[model samples]
Target: MENIAGTKSSLSWAVHISVAALVLIWLFPTVGLFVSSFRTADQIATSGWWKAAFPSEQNLTLRTDPPSTQVQKGGQWVIEGNLFGDKRGATISVYGTSSREISTYKAGETGKFRNGATITVQPNGDYVASSDTKWKGGRGPRVFVTAVTPPEFTLRNYQMVLFDPANREGMARAFFNTLTVTIPATVIPILVAAFAAYALAWMDFPGRALLVAAVVGLLVVPLQLALIPLLSLHNDIGIGKGYLGVWLAHTGFGLPLAIYLLRNYMVGLPRDIIENARVDGATEFQIFTKIILPLSFPALASFAIFQFLWTWNDLLVALVFLIDSTGETTVMTKQIVELLGTRGGNWEILATSAFVSIAVPLMVFFAMQKYLVRGLLAGSVK
Candidate 1:
């Protein structure tokens, strides 16, 4: 007994360690995406998400110029223009003539030039200079700055990706489109397969083994092999490229697996209880409705979660059966793919999209996980 217990403990430890390693590996990119999603496009392009945790040194541009047509006052060049305009409280830590290398100067220090000109900059975009000199023909001198940015995060990216309609169609509508496809696609197969599974498992039937065999056979068939044929069929059946077509496609593809899974779970149900329902003069439908369904809740919930998540995150079927070139029929996955192509450098948008896509699946799993733990699987195994 002690030996068995020790072996069990070792096996459990190995499983736990393996799970931990898998979890970390899985989460690393997700965490990186999440961090990157909050970052600016430039910031994401230049540095990894880890660097965002600390202040980063970057070369940025700063400029000072006279207002358009500034009038001389008291024989002085009363030039005026906004330096670092609309930056929303950016402090000037440094400035330079060329963009290549920028350096900071003390607020009270003077920048002496080769032309006997002096430049002094204040913290508040104010500047003073004394020079017996004139700026070069029709252009002002260029400046560069190396500034330390504090940890600045913004919801603007999320708003832009999810809510801004005039700017673009955005992921919000595609998120809803995904639901439109996913909910029905997930539900139809399960609904149809539940009755089929119940019939095969508990009801007297003709060719039951053959039906099960067919479903199992489909498990090995690659979906890609059928995509073109399915699309041609859709074009023929008058459904064309739309919600109805994709829903039907998903339902067909999902049904075999659904029926197979539900049949295994339904077969494991207690025969005595089903027989007792028969003794109670219940029809097959009634037994299925009242006894089998209530008893098969765990398997149903588990399959629902699985199907819902798959259909929610699916892209290939959407590409083939649904009209995705235009933004109208795009799903979250499709929209995300487009965003990756056009705005790959935008980390925050990517993260926000990722989170939005999975939010519903996460909710369904959390809410239904209880069924897996404490429901019909208990009765089935025993």
Candidate 2:
């Protein structure tokens, strides 16, 4: 009884720990980015996102009156100014005479360092600093002050990414290009492979094992190995460097896996149902259209997810094939890479682009995830 109780407690502890860690791991960066996306460029550069969550202190520089600019009024050189110009409600905590370190006192207090050098900075961007000791000076002491900043966030980055014309050459065009490649590349393989899978799965033929083995073998052969040769083949066939060439390449590359997966799922289907359709005077095409197709929805949807995602995110093949005589045929992945080269410091652009690129995949996953898992498990159980 004690052992069982201990095990239950241990399991509960493990679950709690796992959930806490996962929540932190997922939320930490997302929260940081959420905070950072709203902050000013300077704020982002100077402090971490966590630091931005609380009020932050900033070191500021204020000009002091030179002896030349100072008027000898009441037997003392005096100057008046306020550091925060018309900006209200800034808390000034301390003042320093040098730029190296700004804080020398807290709010409503004076620094011993500034002793005999009374410097006053008001919230309304005016200041008056004077020295009690007689002034004979070339340069007055440089004044430093610390000010508090409040929380801030903005949707400017999204606006700049979506609506800005300058972004067109980048994500906007690449988005369209990705869709162009992804749609055709996805459609061609599914259409061709569906027929091929139906043939391989249901139709009787000689050398069927050998053909299936060849298709399966192609799966293990890395597509990278055939890059140059396939490019050469395209060139030889006069399909060089265009959307059609790219579409064909993706279809060819995506075909073997598609055919294999679909065949496995299709073949597992009850042979009796297929034979009954045949016995009822249906041709192979009619059987596939009526019976096989309905049963194969899960497999087809799963393959569609795979193809759409692969084609959408592909960089290398797109580089080799769709990369152009015209520079217009660039995809999202390629554009993101190029932006990293040119706009390295633009975090807003980088984050927004990344989010935009993944947005479709997220939608696709949510939409077809059920079928993907179901199709994958189809043949395994039976």
Candidate 3:
């Protein structure tokens, strides 16, 4: 008994450790991207997002105000300004007159120039340069600074991604375009598939088994097989390539699985409730709309999520059926690929774009995860 209890405790600990490890593995990249999205391009390039929460020590080359900006202050010529320009939180640990001696003077200490001038820089980046004689340089003198910059984050990446008109890779239009594609594609299939599934499952019909079997077979058919044929058909029918073509194509491809899942779920509903509804003079359509539809919420939500994510992230379908040379209707997935080609080295932009693209799907999944889980489990049992 004692040995068995010890073994059980060991297994329980092992399971917990394994689960914890899996959670960390899944969250690591997600957390990294979320953090990177808030950072500026320079900061993202200089350091990892994991290190974003702490101050960073950096060597910076900067300059003071030029001779043209020098002013007469108490009979001395002086150039005074803030080096960091509204970025007031940085602390200059040390600085120097030359690059070779970057950390020669501590923050706030004045360093004498070769021309009998002295410059003092505070921790907050405020600087004052004064000379007993008139200043002579055409440009400002170079100042090398070693500063402890506070952790920085910005919404500029998001702004550029979402709102900047000059940004060709902006997700604003693509996000809406994706929504335009997804909403109809997701909804139309549910309504059509639910009616068909109800007919195949509950309502008696000739060749019902054969039709269900056909839908099941379609589940195994590769979408690639239908792409060329479907596109040709769409073109021939004058629909061409646009939101309508894409929506119809998504609905067609998604219906088989939707029908299969819903048929199985609907068939498993208690026959007594459906029979009694019919006995109370409920028509087939009425029974479906008023009774089966309400009880089949889990299945509907599950397939809605599946189709929404599928159509939202579909690059091939969008490329083949929807997008054209006009480029007005590019979706998020296509926009991300465009970013890969145009801003490949720009990790901040890429990270933020990628994060924005996925954020909606993640929210949808989390919101409907309970229904999705129940639908899967219930569908499998029946």
Whole-model Cα lDDT per candidate?
Answer: 0.73, 0.76, 0.89
Worst 10 residues of 1 by lDDT: 373-382
> Can you give the lDDT of residue 202 in candidate 1?
77
Candidates 1 and 2 compared: the better one by lDDT is 2
Task: Give candidate 2's TM-score.
Answer: 0.76
lDDT of 2: 0.76
Error at 162, model 1, angstroms: 0.8
Query: 309-376, model 3: which lDDT tens digit per residue?
Result: 89988999999999999999889999899889988999989999999999999998898888777656
- Tell me the TM-score of model 3: 0.86
Indicate whether candidate 1 or candidate 3 has the larger TM-score: 3
| Residue-by-residue lDDT tens digits, candidate 1, 54-173 | 767565666556434344556554444445555634455666554444564654356654555556765544556544434444444445555555556677777887889875736888
Global Cα lDDT for candidate 1: 0.73
| Candidate 1 residue-wise lDDT at 231 | 88
Candidate 3: segments with Cα more than 4 A from true spot: 1-8, 66-68, 72-77, 94-124, 130-144, 279-281, 378-382
Clashes of each: 2, 9, 0
Ranking by TM-score: 3, 1, 2
Ranking by lDDT: 3, 2, 1
TM-score of each: 0.80, 0.76, 0.86
Number of the predicted model whose lDDT against the real structure is largest: 3
Clashing pairs in 2: 80-127, 80-128, 81-126, 81-127, 81-128, 82-125, 82-126, 82-127, 84-125
